[model samples]
Target: MSGRAADRWAETRAPSLAEIEALADAAFAALPEEFRTLCAGVRIHVDDFPDEETLTEMGCESEFDLLGLFRGVGLAQSGEVVSGQMPNAVWLYRRPLLDYWAEHDETLGHLVTHVLVHEIGHHFGLSDDDMAGIEAAADDITPSEA
Candidate 1:
């Protein structure tokens, strides 16, 4: 195995929900200021697996079908805030994310960032092409650049 691969195997354990949440937070913070500014008031939640209702609602064959989900009115569709509107939120599935990481060649932080950007893209009413550009822009930002 490569040095990096060996390093990962040194202490094999799934990242806890809190750890995933931290990764999401770091990923969001690393995004460009313009992108982050548009995501104001969004909340993030991390769970092991999506609930049964969400599974059926999303028409998924398995819990692993979804890595993340966005629930709320898109920015473009928002008119006026009601008296008691549920805040827009993003839900990240920890087990599904970990499973995808094990099967892919990317780092966990990168994956979390990708999902975060994608969900936020939906909020901004952006097309897939636009989101791809944003992801590319994000990929260009190294830790030093961030």
Candidate 2:
């Protein structure tokens, strides 16, 4: 490798939980306003990997098997907010995401955005096709529109 390439590689480190959370925020900000409005109260969390219980519940053979997850009631499953209810939440698995990113041809930011949107899709209880359409539409949003 070239001297500069090697130097750059040496300085690179995996993103921390806070950095991953920041990436998620930027990604959410980049989505269309309408969608953002719909995602008003969802919480996002970043962790190195899914917890042992989550892995077991999801039937994941390895921590790397899952990149992210969503928890809480979807719009389709909601009637009205109850006083004692927990808020909706999305969990981003950093180690798994980084592992996946290493094996794929995409920017980390782009991958984060993709995962965040998919989690939000779960919050809305959208079908795969419906989520795909929303993602396509999100891509179509221009700077001015955003």
Among all candidates shown, the one with the greatest lDDT: 1
For 1-146, candidate 1 gives per-residue lDDT tens digits of 99988887797777899999998987888788898888888899999999999999999999999999998888878734567888889999999999999999888888998998898888888888988877777777735211
Clashing pairs in 2: none
lDDT per residue (tens digit) for residues 2-102 in model 2: 99989988998988999999988878887878888998888999999999999999999999999999988888787356788888889999999999999
The CA lDDT of each predicted structure is: 0.87, 0.85
TM-scores for all candidates: the values are: 0.88, 0.87
Residue range with the least summed lDDT across 10 consecutive positions in model 2: 137-146
* Candidate 2, position 54, lDDT: 96
lDDT of 1 at 117: 89
The CA lDDT at 112 in model 1 is 91
Model 1's alpha-carbon lDDT is: 0.87
